[model samples]
Target: MVSLIIFSILSLDTILNVPELKNAHYGICFLDLKNDSIIYDYNSEKLFVPASNMKIITTAASFYFLGKEFRYKTNFYLRGTIKDRKLYGDIILQGGGDPYFNLENLERFADKIISMGINEITGGLLIIDDYFTDERLPAGWSWHYLDAKYAPEISALSFNKNVVSVRMRPTNAGELANVYIYPSTGYVKLINRMTTTTNSENIIIYRKPEENTIIVDGMINIKNARDIDVAVKDPAMFAGEYLKERLNARNIKVSNPVARIRTYELFLRQKQPVLIDSVLSPNLLEIIKETNTESENLYAEILLKTLGAYRYKEGSFNAGLNAVKEFLNICRVDTQNISLWDGSGLSKHNLISPAVLIAVLKFIYNSNLYYDFYNSLPQPGKGTLKARFNGFSDTLRAKTGALQASSCLSGYIKINGQDYAFSMLFNNFVCPIKKIMQIQERIIRAFYEEMRRTNVDNTELLKPVEVIQQ
Candidate 1:
């Protein structure tokens, strides 16, 4: 059992010197908010894989480039005239890169069409998805994660975050397990070879690349139910099919199947489209809140592309990365030490120093968007910190990130009614992640306990104590 001495002083240096962190490549920086002073630092200039901590940078850049009130607008248009309650023109669904577009929004669009007294559409549904590049996946993403819900395909037109849930229920031993897909859409086909077994559960779900054929093969115990969320192969087509279904469900007769085209092809048709209705996404601030609070990969990626679309008129990964770089320059970050490959730190290619993250947090703290950005981070017992920092609720707000062997926590912590920004990143550690997390918490607790002692001198509190490693 581990023993602790209450009177013994603790600091970041002492906490990290233990055997638990001997093999980890890590960096840390703690900055006092009031004086903009560096209270403590260890390997702060070294580059490390940031994991979801990269969202801090993405969130800052998004607020800088796309204001708090920015919203994605998806418009519907009619290319043909309506006569005798029958529309003779095609209904165009133009995508505006709305990441939150869902079935409810589609239903609203259908209802709006019905309100226009249009029962029949003589032309096919034209889906315009050229606002972003055709590349669905970003660079440096692992091939193994392509089918995961967290790594869903990015598209200008997305439905339900481009993922579908597959629920598997076990019956009896030696029998096939029952499988059900959510949204009840025929967008993908599933081949279920899952068997109910008397032993422990061992299930595997795989979706073929660029294809909608998902294979469920494995054995599940009779006592358990497995639910897996798989990414869709094509987001734009998925949206088109789902939208068509929604329109048909509302008794709207669509004459032809949906066809997807780029802006160039639509302009060549020589027919001007008239606007009918549109859907607006939640503002940028709310989206960033979700992105940072939940460490959502899809939202971060969408915001990156949206930035690209706004700045360069090209919604591609390279353009979005360029926009982020520009924002970093404005923040006066040392870009030479950072290598950002994707908006979401799912890419192992993303390397950033703790000092860089401190720079971003400092910039946000001093900017006009400080409150909005600060409030976006999750407090203890909320979001990603839901299970962490018990009893430290209002005093701590942070972002947590983990990717395989990488782990990080960064944000603000209050001590004696004073707020301070800090970042702790650990990468390529052979030790169990739980141990690393405990060490991180210990470091935080050390700072909290040491700095909060009213009678202790500032210099004495900052002194590091020698820790004996087990």
Candidate 2:
């Protein structure tokens, strides 16, 4: 059986020794976990930005420290008195930076208040959103992305990701863009007055903000469209405005007023806080699923915050990094080459070598979360990797990373019923987009095909080739 396996390995190596692929400006490493062996490697020690693939590390660290049952809690407190089933004092909403807060959840939370038989509030309504302290957004994130849906800055009191979808439709006369907010609240202030052209009216332009203002710079191509979607600057403010209207509509009258304040002063309110209700987020497991499956930046950022708050006992980025570094040390992995700015690899300064990633992958594979970690990756023909592997998604499983001039794939591959952990990263490749993707596909296919054939010598297949001086 051993001889046959060796022969099979050798044959596979000979097949994979191709000029086009071998000479490509890329780095890769394939490890046979079943036997604790290196199947193949080429420049795998070179460091490169992992892009969204960095989510894997963040997710793993989260799962390790936070546990799967963890849930972010948003609490409502009452610091005043309720007279005649009315809040005679102040109503406080304390938010701890739950990134998953949404309109539905906020509405449901408000509905719970209605269920409490409180029809009128004689005191003021105050919201506290100072949960997270990090002011630095991810590094290298495009300034234009602030207007895009996914790149909004992380906030402590975020509501609907501080995003509001505005539907912009062209007028019947074909000259005006009619903007409509989906949950149409009267609070949001539109900064740009968009004029719609007949040809550009139908396009749906997504806008997010880097600061307090979100501007819609793109055109929606749809004509006679009654609405379009755009992200707002402050979710808490929008939620507050919408909630006020909602309460008013439900016949809940308020005499004190509405505002946002720090939670530390809850003691100073006329009425001390009474725990009205609590809302729980999806379990940590599902959040991890979202993180790995969709590479959700919101989820990734929240994980980092959670790490800072819980693991290191410090509510800051430095604390988060300290926690991550300590965790890496425990895993016996080197931390010298990595400089992490954010849990999401959205930061350009984020760095790690293919070898370090492989080591991390192997550690996770050998740890208690072996199967769970592997299962979280997008299958080739499905999830995010659906278009990857030339549509042969079933036979491959790898974490893919992509940034301008930097494309990468790293994870476990199940080729011909045998599993192999691999990391393939291409950085600084001055190739065109199509050619880059093609090169990636060819490399993946070549590795898959080579692993299936026999006579492959794992060590020999990965031997570094000789370099000639210029």
Candidate 3:
């Protein structure tokens, strides 16, 4: 097993040890958790874009600052008085940076109002999105990603993940494809140029930059009802309109039906949105599960913003990023090589080294948060890695991240009851992304095989130590 590990590392060094890393960059690090010693290291300090793996840092910061049971609260306020079952005031939906606030919760809010016998609401629905300003979208996000579900607009009052569901299907085989935007509102305008075709389907969805217009022009195979979710221009508007639709369906008359989003401070220097009724998000532990396991970008980003709001009392992207940095420093993890941009790691500007990741893992392993943090990561054959690591599923627990030609996998591995943490990052790989993943899988298998032998040798006393320089 030890020979196999050496052969594996040598093999990986040859394959990954390319010329100057102009075409690709590989950062690898492995640690023996029990001994606090380096099992292997190859350019571990070299900086590389971390992609979604940055969620590890965000999640770690979250667990350290925001306890596992931390819950997000979005307050509902009736800004007006009720007269004989008639509301003479506005309905203010104050956002508390709830990332998972969905359409069902708004429906329940409407139900709660109707149950109070307020059949007629003679006021407008105002969504206070002041927790963060209009500059809610992160600075480094790509323009094209804004139209996709992966990168939604960041706001204090985000709803339905701040997405507009697109429903389309083939129409009569020759006519244009049928298209409709759900939660049907003027928040987004659709321009459909898609046509039914028998050829291979080539679908392309594009959003007008800085606008609420989307162009869905593509080819669809026959007889298919497909749904695609795209991020909306305004989350506050989306929430307001959807709530209005639900309330109207229940026969609650809204004399003013326009959806309004406000950036004004609720009352005090801080936004003092008075609570009337509210919805509490799932606890931070479960949220961290979704963020790491499913690689849910929205969950992680919201957790970052929530961290900012909780510690700094301001829920902006900058505030959250600064807070995360502060947490890393507190943990004694080196902050010099890390460049954190967005909490989700979707932004290309974020840079993190493999050694930095392992340092964080060491911190989590020694702390009381070991269990929750470990389980929060996607296990083999689970979560985002549901189809990954085919035979080694039970033995591997890790987080997978990718961005175009760049890919990464980082996490903990338990061999013969001895734990280890490792991070493998590849940047600017010219080959297919799957090829990089396959290489990662093989290297890990070697590590697993060799580590088992090392555990036995430790029990017997002398252990061989060899460091390979790339």
Q: Tell me the tens digit of each residue's lDDT in model 1 across 286-375.
A: 999999998889999988888899899999999999999998888788777689998989999999988888888888888899889988
Quality of model 3 by C-alpha lDDT = 0.82
Residue-wise C-alpha lDDT for candidate 3, range 272-342, written one tens digit per residue: 44556899999999999999998988888888888888889888888999899898887776777678899
Better of 1 and 3 by TM-score: 1
- Candidate 2 C-alpha lDDT tens digits along 195-238: 66656443535443434433444444544554434556655666
TM-score of model 2 vs. true structure:
0.85
Write down the lDDT that model 2 would get.
0.68
Off by over 4 Å in 1: 1-10, 264-271, 455-457, 464-470
Per-prediction TM-score: 0.93, 0.85, 0.91
Candidate 1 Cα lDDT to native: 0.86
Between the candidate structures 2 and 3, which one is better when assessed by TM-score? 3
Ordering by lDDT: 1, 3, 2
Model 1 scores worst on lDDT over the 10 consecutive residues at 1-10
Local distance difference test values of all predictions, in order:
0.86, 0.68, 0.82
The list of candidate 2 runs beyond 4 A from truth reads 1-25, 134-136, 200-214, 217-231, 255-258, 268-270, 390-392, 455-470
* lDDT leader: 1
